[model samples]
Target chain A: MKARVHVMLKDGVLDPQGEAVRHALGTLGFDGVEGVRQGKVIELDLATEDAAAAEAEVREMCEKLLANTVIEKYDIEIG
Target chain B: MKARVHVMLKDGVLDPQGEAVRHALGTLGFDGVEGVRQGKVIELDLATEDAAAAEAEVREMCEKLLANTVIEKYDIEIG
Candidate 1:
């Protein structure tokens, strides 16, 4: 099975890297870009064949290492 | 309007960060991890409501600033 994880900063958190991108975009003349938020997408190739088990295991991975639970949130999709 | 962009390194590219993650996962006792790849997901809030135009603009952003185009490929999703 394959697992895809998207880890994003939680709401109300400040993202300086995203802010820098937004500012650079504005400077590049692409106006009307009101906001920007950046996150991580991790793709994992697992040895498991069961989708349910893969999802559960990937979720555990997220909680243990993939995501910073206090400041970030993660979503997992198993295929 | 909103646009979501997923930027990933090309298949042949070496991803040290992902390798480190995979190694860490093994050390943490999460076995059966065959491989790992990492990417970026960027969300943009646009002032325009037209999805078509938003997609086009975001594509331009990717070609010009968002993606390296040499080692990275980006996909745009307008919502």
Candidate 2:
């Protein structure tokens, strides 16, 4: 099975790295870029064949380690 | 318009960060965690209402700034 997780900062959270990217884009002549939010993608190749099990396991992984649940949110996709 | 870009290392590329994450997960008792790859997701808010134009502009940004065209590949989604 394959699992993909997207970890993104929650609304109302300050994202300095995202701000830096936005500033860099402005300097690179992409002035129309209004806002930028940067996140992470984690792809996992699992041995399990069960889609439901894969999703549940990956969700646990996200809650335990992949994400800072307080300031960030994560979405999981299993295939 | 909104644009989401996913930047990932190409196959056969060495990803020390991903390896480290995998190792950490193993130590945290998630032994079934096998191959893990990490990437970046960049979300942009643009001024243009045209989805095609927004995608084109964001593609340019990815090619020129957001992604290293050498060892990384980027996919852009516009809305």
Candidate 3:
């Protein structure tokens, strides 16, 4: 199975990196981009074939290590 | 309009960050995670309602600054 995990900073949390990217974009002449929030995508190749199990396992991975639950949230897409 | 850009390193590129994350996962006892590739997600809030325009603009942003065309590929999702 394959899983893609999208990890994003939680709302209200400060994202210095994201802000930096936004600033860089403005400097590069890309206008009308009101806001930019940068997150992460983690692609995982698992050894299982069961979609349900893969999702559940990946969720555990997210909660345990893939994400910082205090400031980040993660969504898992299994295929 | 809103847009989400997924940027990933091209295959065969060295991913030290991804390797670090994978190592950390092993330390945390999450076995069976054979591989992990890390990328970035840029979420933009655009000032236009035209989906086509948003997509085009976002792609320009990606090519200009959001992603490094030499080693990174980006996918855009507009809504």
Model 3, residue B62: what's the lDDT?
86
Regions of model 3 farther than 4 Å from truth: none
DockQ values, each candidate: 0.93, 0.89, 0.86
As a whole number from 0 to 100, the lDDT of residue B59 in candidate 2 is 86
lDDT of 3 by residue, B1-79 (tens): 8899999999999888888888988888777778889999989888889998888888888888889999999999998
Q: Chain A of model 3, TM-score against the native?
A: 0.96
lDDT of 1 by residue, A3-76 (tens): 99999999999999899999999999999899999999999999999998898899999999999999999999
TM-score: model 3 vs. ground truth: 0.94
**Whole-model Cα lDDT per candidate?**
0.95, 0.92, 0.89
Off by over 4 Å in 1: none
Candidate 1 lDDT over B1-79, as tens digits, reads 9899999999999999899999999999998999999999999999999999999899999999999999999999888
lDDT by residue (tens digit), candidate 3, A1-79? 7899999999999988888988888898877888888999999988889999898888888988889999998898998
Q: Could you tell me how far off, in angstroms, the CA of residue A17 lies in candidate 1 after the best superposition?
A: 0.9
Q: Can you give the lDDT of residue A32 in candidate 1?
A: 85
Put the candidates in TM-score order, highest first: 1, 2, 3
Candidate 1 backbone collisions, by pair: none
Order of the predicted models by DockQ, top scorer first: 1, 2, 3
**Of the candidates numbered 1 and 3, which has the greater DockQ value?**
1
Which regions in candidate 2 have their CA more than 4 angstroms from the true location?
none
